[model samples]
Target: MASQGDRARDALLDAAEELFARNGIDAVSNRRIVEHAGAANHSAVAYHFGGRDGLLRALVERHHEEMSRRRRELMEQLGESPNIHELVTARLRPLIELLDSLPKPSWRAQFMSQISAVPSAVAVAKEVIGDANLPDDLRFINGAVDGIPESVLRGRAYLLGSMVVGVCADQEAKMNEDANKGNWEQVGRFLIDAAAGMIGAPVTDPDGAVRYPNVPLI
Candidate 1:
């Protein structure tokens, strides 16, 4: 069984995630989180998490553990070699699976999206969760294309992150409406297809010169 302190800490995390999702993370004060958590101590957040930054890191690390586990399993299933599409799916599927498992009115996706907007928070998240850029993953990506600049590939990787976060946030937000329910399966497929193309797409220079014009997209 969890101790009372553990329960209080979890309550604060839960409340903070919801409030941050509903009202941008910057707008939701630590006091609001404490009150929403129903903790008797006004300094419960500070006592439990140290501060808002610590609380955010805790929330991200909690989910990242599960996501990382799922990614490892997916990567293991890929065996010795995998194509771009398979690699992209492996990288992206965990978030979709996590969201699918959540009940209605989930705040996780929105919370992540809000966090991505804050550079400091994003750095903290990167410190905790890292990214999809595993060694093998990067090796595969680097050799997947020829003549494309490494700089362009780096930019595409950042684009993929922003795209996934923004799309997931939008889908979660629309869950409140009667019509237009979020279709995560379709979303997953779309992301996988789009990301594969993005990862291996031809790089064009400003002067209309295309690098790796023969690059095949997945």
Candidate 2:
């Protein structure tokens, strides 16, 4: 059983997520969240979440929880051992699905872009989603890099992560540029294929590097 206050708080969080995802954290005001939540108390944001920063943390936590749930389910479906490509696909599928599930894609796109642009938000994101948070289905992907030296793995992982972020950011930018002209479903599919290809490509030594399969620039 939940109290009325609890219900109000939950409503506030829901409204905040909707606004924050669409408009970016800084763009949305506490008053707007309270109004959107249908709360009469003007201090609802502070009462429920301490303040704006607290609200932002709550939003980030909500995303983290949703991601963790999807990751767990995907891992459970994969069984004991899966290959690198499977691991990469499993890791990416939840993210694609999460974005697709949002009611307003434009809002989500703007929200994600804003988060990426903020250095502090980036640090928070990295802390919340470090290597330990990698799903079990994708463990083999990490294992695949075991043959590569630690330094090389670190470098490659950084590069690959940046590539994936860039792909997502570009998709968001394209969506913003021509809302009616682009389809996320199609772009998401292409991204998954492209990411899988990159994950499957062989790693090279740090020294200048050998010729490897070129990751197609999109």
Candidate 3:
């Protein structure tokens, strides 16, 4: 038995996710969200979420929760102690899949692009990452980082994360330009290969020492 306020809040959230995903978060107005939610009170968003920033935070938190749930499900499907590649793929795929399945991919792209450009979005992203309690996933990633030095591992992780974010942002731009045409599978494959190659095995001996792969150093 949900209260009227609770129901209104949920409706607002539902409307906000779609609206924010389609339009940039800054572009979508509180009035529009309330209108979209079919709430009789025009101030429903304010009443429910306090204000626009509060609404955005709620949306981000909900997305984090959903991502966590999807990651857990993927890990369960993979069974115990999956390889680094499997772990990374499992964590990354769901987000791409979500964007692909959105009713208006262009809107998602717009939203993501705005998020990429904003400093506050970075803060929100860091909060989500730090607050995420995925021990199994963390263990798998840390194990992958084992052979590499902490500095290199941190740099590599940042690079890999940035690459994924860049690719997603690029995809969104492409989707906006040509809504009817795009090869998500091809993009996914390219990212998988690119990320793997960047973070792939260190060229080394039995002892924990760095070694270059036997090829023309890039």
lDDT of each residue in 95-199, candidate 1, tens digit only? 898988787778888888887656667767767766434334454666656776665765566677778888888888887454368488888888889989988
RMSD of 1: 5.3
Candidate that scores best on lDDT: 1
In order, what lDDT does every prediction score? 0.76, 0.62, 0.63
Off by over 4 Å in 2: 1-29, 32-40, 79-81, 123-127, 131-139, 145-147, 169-185, 204-218
lDDT of candidate model 2 versus the reference: 0.62
User: How many steric overlaps are in each model, in order?
Assistant: 0, 1, 1
My TM-score estimates for the predictions, one after another, are 0.85, 0.67, 0.67
lDDT of 1 at 20: 90
| Candidate 1 colliding pairs | none
Candidate with better TM-score, 1 vs 3: 1
lDDT of 3 by residue, 162-191 (tens): 567667767776776686657666676677
The local lDDT score (0 to 100) that residue 158 gets in candidate 2 is 48
Candidate 2, residues 117-194: lDDT per residue as tens digits? Answer: 555555555455543233244445667654554444444444555566566766765666676756667766776777
Off by over 4 Å in 1: 131-139, 206-218
Q: Is candidate 1 or candidate 2 better by TM-score?
A: 1
Alpha-carbon shift of residue 174 in model 2 (angstroms): 5.4
Local lDDT at 117 for model 3 = 46
